[model samples]
Target: MQRIRAFRARSTPDRPAPLRRAAAPAVAALALLLPATLSGCAAFGGERSGIVVTTNILGDITRSVVGDEADVTVLMQPNANPHSFGVSAQQAAELEEAELLVYNGLGLEEGVLRNVEAAEQAGTPSLEVAAGIDPLDFAEGESAGQPDPHFWTDPVRTGEAVDLIADAIVEQVGGIDEDRVRASADEYRGEVEALHAEAEERFAALPEERRKLVTDHHVFGYLADRYGFEVIGAVVPSGTTLASPSSADLKSLSDAVRDAGVPAVFADSAQPDRLTRVMAEEADLEIEVVPLFTESLTGEDGDAPTYLDMARYNTGAIADALAE
Candidate 1:
């Protein structure tokens, strides 16, 4: 078990010098124009109710735990990439006024972390869900040794996160029924455990030799670790989609896929799978490129509309793709 840090509702450290310098002018301009822009648009007029979440996955989980106790406003839209999705100025302001802000901290929401930090600086308590869960480190490449932010890939870890998130909501969000929130958390955790068991059983049916995963990026360290799959390689070889794959990286990944006889290369449905496609072509093998809901949830009508749906869909897809 990873050492769980006590949850702190404090501001994060200042942005790097270069980023601060680059943002200073924009910050100044926004400061000058914000008041007028906000006034005309009523950006700050509405009653700021409920918990604000930075990512859709966390938003869905928070909603489950909070139930009708509080309105949960998720900043990231359905089928969006957390690393690169930016919040609007109005949404940023809303974060500052929210009862509590929940984010997947460990550098997952690169685009929104600054806004979360700003919200914390303005006195809104922020919860980093990853802080409470034992996080996996990247096994190799540039991201090795860094805490993996994609803990939701492991259902067991996510079940633990439900406990942490429920506690935070009960303790931080005022006027909520503590008993109700705790009950909801327990209920959700049971569901998560069931999901974990089902996924484990499905994966267990897969032959050990066939339990190899090659993805668009290194997004499945936890999933592979939990289910006994070997991560053959990834096109980008990094944790975040923001990183691009070099020619050498692509070549190596293509070779690995061919060598491992991987039947499918999985990519995030929220992202363009161009790189994965290109790698498939480069490998010159009859391999399938399967898209999974790895990073974000889709709209309500789509396949992965909720957290549990996303996990189940991905698990079934993996089983179908690899257990052949």
Candidate 2:
């Protein structure tokens, strides 16, 4: 189990200096000071139960592996942008009380990262899922050279994540049936492997030219790599949706769209489609804007309630849109 000093301002060697410095001093300081106090309090320690996951995607995966064995709490809500979603005070306190902390730690959760660090400072065992998997760097755009955090787009990589979570639960989380957790992971892994095979066949049916992808942001690097598609460009030109595209960036992307003759541009379902629509309109060509569940999952009544459902839905949506 990975452990850190109890409530100290520790350096994050994996992240850039700018991102490391982005941690709110006030929040970090409070977290640093309160872990001891939080731990010393009988109520806080007594309430520490189950696993706490950062993103809904990982939370769903964790639930699949954990089943009814342990209580799993997900911080990010349905249809919420992972880059901007935040936790409330009660939720923040729960971070310190988590039996294990799991997060997609390639800077995906910009809003809740400090809270994750706070939990780590409080001596909670953590699994940075993306770091454990072999991550690919953003090939181009504003976040070029940085590790791409959107690994969930690839089902094979997602299977690896399931294994990691199961291993963490058995090792870090106490009083759980390790055998049952392992069995659940194996079952889920089989499902993900099937999804990978399905995606391969689905993408293979498309013409080479149709395999090119344009999106609202630089989110499909892993998917493109996995399925042998080219990423033409993104409207935002950055990894996170929080970043805006300059006029020059928009014009450049629009020109690329026109040059490539891409018929459709995919936008995240959680975010507005205005930028994609603008890029499509500016291209002076017939371009369709398709919505995809790229970053977050949805409610039970929605299209993408689970990770598997999200992947299948996206695979079909991309195939159908590009094929047209």
Candidate 3:
């Protein structure tokens, strides 16, 4: 439920290309190209509405659309690293009952891929949100445009994802309140659009040179694409947070950060800051860890409990911090 309050991404007049200094670092550049892990199933919220999402990010949005109509049992648990997630027997059993299974396709949930494959065999319909969004092409020799599944990083794209995902849910799941669900989706979509507009307005005010983003990984590709920002590189040099980073990748990213004159490195607040800290410490640069929302959403008590809330919180954070 943690919310990002420091960083804002907005479209601007001048956009700069990423600095191409060296060949691909030795890290598994292809790994970051892969999507997150997946889950088998679960006894979610003590009631089974037959709708289950693979990740908390999708589950949160689904809950908003389904409301009391369905009880969403999220497969992945809180604080459980989804990149290297493991499924359980109970979770596997839940998939058998799912009429609609929502997930971010495009190789996210790699570990969960096997489970999703199994779920498909069990006759459960899996919906990948990244199915329609414009994808990013990987660097030459990187994982060939496998299409990053982290579209939720960009609020506009996430809004699009929600609209599409909600429709699939209504059409696939039986007895859902169509008027309620569609209206909820439209209302949420309007909020997301507003958040994007506000972010653009706020972030566009930053100095041109400050439009660079350095992070633990290239998760912000969608955000950078939505607004005008250059992704300098990442500490992991891969896609999923489940992978490990090498000392060489650290030095390289730190060098890139200093070279790019970026004031900060973006990190996910939902996860610990050990790696960003290490990267900052090693880089010996004035790097601030701009904690943000990624992968999972917050609970009802959390700051970003829903997709729209996450976008608004992140937009405000990025706008305020970058404007500084």
Q: How high is each candidate's TM-score?
A: 0.85, 0.88, 0.79
Which of 2 and 3 is ahead in lDDT? 2
**In terms of TM-score, which candidate is strongest?**
2
lDDT of 1 at 39: 9
User: All candidates' lDDT scores?
Assistant: 0.80, 0.83, 0.67
Model number with the top lDDT: 2
Give lDDT tens digits, candidate 1, residues 1-324.
221111123333421110111123444353343211110011132333578889999999999998999889999999888889998999999887876778888889899887876775554556677755767778976787777889999999999889878867765677789999999999999999999999999999999999999988889999999999999988888998889989998999899888999999999987888989999999999998898999999998999999999999999999999977
**TM accuracy, model 3:** 0.79
Candidate 3, run of 10 with poorest lDDT? 2-11
Candidate 3 local lDDT, 1-324, one digit each (tens): 221111111213222111111122421242223221211222233333478788877887778777777668888776455676667878877765676678766667777777765665554545666755565744311333446667887777878777777766665566678888888888877877777888788778877787877767667778888788877887777777766788887888888777777777778787888988998888787767888776667667877776667777777777666666
| Lowest summed lDDT window (length 10), candidate 1 | 34-43
Model 3 CA lDDT for position 94: 77
What clash count goes with each model? 0, 0, 19
Worst 10 residues of 2 by lDDT: 34-43
